[model samples]
Target: MQNETTKIALLVAIATLIFLLVPVFLILYIRSYNRHKKNHFLEKQNMQQKFESEMLQTRVEVQDQTMQSIATELHDNVGQLLSLTTLTLNSVNVNDEEKARKKIDNSLALVNKSIKELRELAKLLHGEQLVESGIGHAIDQEINWLNKAGTYELKVNNHLVDLQITSPDKDLIILRLLQEIINNIIKHAQAKQIHIDTYLEKNKLHLKVADNGIGFDPNEMKMKKSGMGLNSIYKRIEMINGKLVLNSAPGEGTSISIEIPYP
Candidate 1:
């Protein structure tokens, strides 16, 4: 009878030990899982901070580019108009009534033209405001500036002008991307004709630019990493979770297409 009692006590003690250890092991497992979650949260937060920082930098660069464009327009365009108006007014003979009147009329016409150009400049100056209205209008404004040069035979089909959705950050990046591409053409492409198409479909925005320029080898460019502008374009696109497609060959033309998710 004493031996049976000893066996019972031993079994009870073992069971009690298991019961106590179970909670301890469960708590350890939960603590490990919680730690993993905390680390993941910190990683995601860091990524978000980095993204916002890059976006702010992008905005500053865009503003700088806009100011440069405004300065160019003032120097090359509006300044010339004002200068011509001055010349016309100075050439007038105050004594010759008819001649003076004619000169005065010409000056007035030039002044009106200058005013019109200034109004357009004002629109360009409000780059951020343009984005606020909608990305489509902002895009139209950019194209208008490019069209002013009349260097390329441009075929523009922009359907985004009436788009209802807006993504402010992405809009600026998109504009910068287009500007970079156009700058590349002006500097190196030597293309005679350029076509730009933009539209929205299936909750995605698409932009396409094609040039009849002397194209280069894409593989070679990637290997060299000398295409700084192209690299920047790729980085910006990736940041926005967008896709870029390029098609070009040695003697053939070049075409680039970008698709981005919309808000």
Candidate 2:
């Protein structure tokens, strides 16, 4: 009887230990998961903050560029128009009825022309309202601007033209992404050729830009955290629930692919 009692007590102790250990293990697991979740959220927030700051700086630069063009227009075009209108008004005479009427009409016409030109300048003051027609035309416009340089041999296959859906919000962001990529190429790529392809497949929009440029190791960029250019791209991609793939190596050139959900 004594031996049987000892065995039974030993088994009970073993069972109690396992029961307590199961809950302990479960609590530790929950704590670990919660920590990971918190860290992810914090990282996302930091990235967003950085992206917003970068965007602010970019907007300021755009405004500065725009102001330069506006100043030129004011001097060369609008100023001349306004000056002519003033001369016409000053020459108006009441002595001769027909002459007075003609001068007044010319002045009115000149003033109206000036108003129209000023209105256009005002619109441009908004820092170039791009993609106004559609995403397709917008990309074409960017391509045309790049072509004017006569620097890169370009090959473009853009299927986004036939796409009927419109996502104005995403369109602007995507356009900016392309601009940033192109800017990087111009500043750093030393690229001789560029190939751009945008299309729709499997309910996702794909945009690819490849350049035969002097490439750098992407891993090194990440390790160095090379400024906000790449980080902004990644953060904006995340915000739109998009994906980006970047491939590059020393002397191998670079290719970037972006996929985003449609409207």
Candidate 3:
């Protein structure tokens, strides 16, 4: 009887051990699952944070570009025109009434022109609003300013003017990209002709800028890291999952084509 009792107690002890271990194993499993969930949440949160940060940086860069363009216009175009007007007025002489009259009339004409240019500059001051109007309008405004220089023969075809969709973020990036391209052209291309085409097809936006400029080998430029503007273009394009193709050769014109998915 004592042996039988001993066996029963031993069996009970084994069963109790297993029962206690079952709860411990279950607790461990639950903890592991919770940890995985937490890690996944953190990863997603990090990605969102990174995206926001990039977007903010892009906005600031765009604003800076706009301000720079404004400064250039004020100094190179408007300021020069006003200065000429002033000079013409200062040279006026009462004794030579005929010449003085002509000078006054010329100054009047220049003042009118300056006023018009100032109005355009005002539109540009609202750069963000220009983007709000639509990417097409914003592009047209930039092209108009470029045309004012009368340095380049511009041929443009923009079909997204009546686009019903809007993507503000992408629009800003696109505008900045165009600004950078134009800056590069003005600073280095020495081109007399520029052709720009923009349209949307298959839910993809396409922009092409071709210039009759003194082109250089793109591979050499990339190797030399001399095209800082090109580098910036690539970085911004990649951020938006866009693609860019550049074609150029020495003595040949340069053409840049960009494709991006649209809303």
Candidate 4:
């Protein structure tokens, strides 16, 4: 009888211990979960901050590029036009009616051209708003500017102009990417023939730019860590989960193809 009583006491003690441990385990599990949740929230917030910072940088770069173009146009084209108009007017003689009439006509035409050029510059003032309509239109506008330079034989086929949906952040990043690529080409490609193509397929946006310019080995440049532009391109691509394929050789021209997720 004493042994049975002792066994019952032991069993009760074991049950009580287990009952106590279950709540302890539960509390520990809840605390661990809460910690994990907090950490996750912090990580997400950090990513958001990083994205906003990148956006700001991209915006500033775009504005800087616009301002540079405006300055160049003012000095090289409009300033020259206005200066020529001034010269033409100064040469006019009041005593020679017919000659003066011709000079006046020429000055009027020059002034009109200046006005048209200024109007175009006014449109460029909206460079930041270029992507508001759609990326397709924005890219076309860039191409139009390049065409104006008459520096290359350009072949462009852009189908994104009619795209119905948009992702604002992605659109801006993509436009900046294109701008960077074009700048690299203009600065280094030394190519007379350039081609650009963009389209949407299977929920992916595709961009391909090729030029018949002097090209360098991609692997060599990457090994040397010499291409800041290339590094920037890779970083931006990673941020947006895009893919890049670049082909180049010493004598062969360069081709860059990019694929990005779309809305």
Candidate 5:
């Protein structure tokens, strides 16, 4: 009788211990899962931040190099040629009717064309005005100057919506993104006509730049990393808390629309 009582007590104690241990184990498991999730999210954020920083640095470096090359061209080559042409025209005698008149006219025309090209190049090289003049005017000026070359056509539908909403950081991102997109079209699109439309809707800025260029399959482009320009533009947009949509197909040309919400 005593042995039976002892056995019953022992079994009860064992069962109670298992019940307690089960809950403790479950609590520990839940804690571990939560910790893992937190770590994963933090890691993802870190990676995104790092990517944005690197991209911005790379873009600035490339822009600096381009500006340097353009400056050298404008100061050393074009400026020297124009000066020499002016000197030659001035030295010619006006009394020689036919020869002097013909040479002066030709020189004058060439100098004017050179000056126009140089001005366009200077505009393209300038990056500081993005923050100074605000985004709308800066972008409009760029489009107008770009059109002067007649290589690309630009059409702006909604023009009077220049909201003072861009931060210095955001401005650079926007400018760089636009430059990349335009450069891409010039390089790969073989695009003749480009259209740009900007509008403000519901406190969000929307910009659309489209080209009637030779388009390709997005899937193939992604697979081969062929659309570096598109990739750069989209990534910059993402960095700035914006969303980008790319629409295009082979022979259909391409259009990219970016929307950014302002706080």
Candidate 6:
């Protein structure tokens, strides 16, 4: 009887050990599985980010190529055709002066229209990829457009010629800044003089757009009211992690200074 009791006790002890050990082993196994799963998820996220970045880069490249092609077509094909048509009309051998004059007038009108369209297309093309070429090239292109368009005397004093601003967001920042400034001048400034200056200091890039026009106080917006031009300019500068400083008051002219970190 004593031997049988002893054997029974040992059997019960072995059974309890197996039961506890099984659950502990299962718990450890589950923890290891979860860790592996989490690592895999992180790796997938990393790969996805890389893929998105590559796709964005490719899209930009394609857009730039397309803009270049359009510019070429406008300048070479459309412009040449318009010029040829005008020349042909001018050289028409007509004895009747009235008929010749009418034809000449029509040809002149058509030529002017075509030139306007080509110029607009050229500006669009130039703006699209100006940053890739550099800030100086971009400013030069804008000056060229302004000179040809006769909108205003767009002067630029680009001190930092080799300024390395390679941010993907640089183009948008420059375009919005310039467009807002020019549009404001056209609509409200009523001034013939406009100047743009660029300088860099303490790893920050600074730009100034000044015009000899009717200006308003920046602090007295509630008193004088801020127009769409001023509001849009401020919003755009803010979007690019930059700040704007307005140095103007009523009858003092407007000067806008923008500062952004150099990338």
Alpha-carbon RMSD to native, per candidate: 2.3, 7.2, 4.0, 1.8, 5.4, 9.9
lDDT of 6 by residue, 1-263 (tens): 99999999999999999999999999999999999999999998987686466445544653564475456657765777687776869676689888888778878777787777677666566555665666666666555556654657667798766766666455545645665676677777787888989877997878888998888767666445566356656655665578888888778788988898876
TM-score for each model:
0.91, 0.56, 0.80, 0.92, 0.67, 0.56
Q: How high is the lDDT of residue 243 in model 5?
A: 95
**Model 3 alpha-carbon drift over 4 Å, by segment:** 1-33, 95-100, 221-226
Candidate 3 per-residue C-alpha lDDT over 76-150 given as tens digits, one digit per residue, 9 for 90 to 100? 988999999998998999899999999999999999999998888888889889898899998998888789788
What lDDT does each candidate get?
0.91, 0.80, 0.90, 0.90, 0.74, 0.71
Model with the higher TM-score, candidate 3 or 5: 3
| lDDT (10s digit) by residue, model 1, range 48-72 | 9988987898889778888988999
Q: Please give the lDDT score at residue 45 for candidate 1.
A: 97
Writing each residue's lDDT as its tens digit, candidate 5 over 18-105 gives 9999999999999999999999999999987986776668558547745864776678667876887888788788899888988888
| Model 5 misplaced stretches (Cα beyond 4 Å) | 1-52, 58-62, 65-84, 87-90, 94-126, 158-161
Error of 2 at 105 (Å): 32
TM-score of 1: 0.91
Better of 3 and 4 by TM-score: 4
Clashes per model (N, Cα, C within 3 A): 0, 0, 0, 0, 0, 0
What's the lDDT for candidate 4?
0.90
Which runs of model 1 end up more than 4 angstroms from their true locations? Answer: 1-17
Clashes of 5: 0
Task: Write model 4 residue lDDT over 22-99, tens digit each, in one string.
Answer: 999999999999999999999999999998999899888877877887898899889999999999999999999999
Best by lDDT: 1
lDDT of 1 at 185: 86
Pairs of residues at least 3 apart in sequence or in different chains that clash in candidate 3: none
Worst 10 residues of 4 by lDDT: 123-132
